[model samples]
Target: MSAPFLRGVEALAQFTAREGAGAAPARGHIERLLVDGEEHEHRLGIWYANTKQRRDKLNPAQRTALADLGVTWA
Candidate 1:
């Protein structure tokens, strides 16, 4: 397992677990990560998501939920 892969997975999981309210989309957006084994050439983006709904804009309730999830947006 690569560090990039692990970081990406961890971030994705945290984002999903908090964003997905049992019905939220399981799909994820594209993200990039870097590993120690390679140079800039080793950087890559992996798209991974497993939910039921698509994430668009957050509603008032959803925003509150996100805050509760410890996510502070600017």
Candidate 2:
């Protein structure tokens, strides 16, 4: 997977961790992550929407990751 892909997944995981189960982020939601000692922000809600729309293009691992985060559409 690409770095951006992993980062987006990581962002969602962090969002899920903080928001708890059965929570869906708002469309403008953003999540921040620290990688290699640097901080990055991900537009998590936008990413989730886009990912759900493009679900057919996602590989098995990607789908599984999202599903593990309790994403119903995944």
Candidate 3:
């Protein structure tokens, strides 16, 4: 991934860690990252799917965020 793409993912992770998972700001940041990183759809999709598989470990907000992004175990 490019620096900016990695930075966006890092920012999202940091925001979730600091603000608690699923915060609206964090979700919104993730949405922006998705849009900005559209060129990396395959990688993002893989990440999303992996996250979805770990949904049980995620907070409600985090799960919802992934869902909103179309991540699904099915």
Model 3 steric clash pairs: none
lDDT of every predicted structure (CA atoms): 0.39, 0.86, 0.46
Using TM-score, rank the candidates from best to worst: 2, 3, 1
Question: Per-prediction RMSD in angstroms?
Answer: 11.3, 1.1, 10.4
- Winner on TM-score (1 vs 3): 3
TM-score top scorer: 2
What TM value does model 3 have?
Answer: 0.33
Compared with the true structure, what per-residue lDDT tens digits does model 2 show for residues 1-74? Answer: 77777888899888889989658888899888898899988898898888888999999898888899898888
> How many clashes in each structure?
5, 0, 0
* Candidate 3 residue-wise lDDT, 4-40, digit = tens: 4354345445545666655434222343333455732
> Which is the winner by lDDT between candidate 1 and candidate 2?
2
Look at candidate 1 and tell me the lDDT of residue 40. Answer: 31
Off by over 4 Å in 2: none
- Kindly indicate the candidate among 1 and 3 with the higher lDDT: 3
* Residue 43 local lDDT, model 1: 16
- Candidate 1 has its poorest 10 consecutive residues by lDDT at 43-52
Segments in model 1 whose C-alpha atoms lie over 4 Å from true places: 21-74
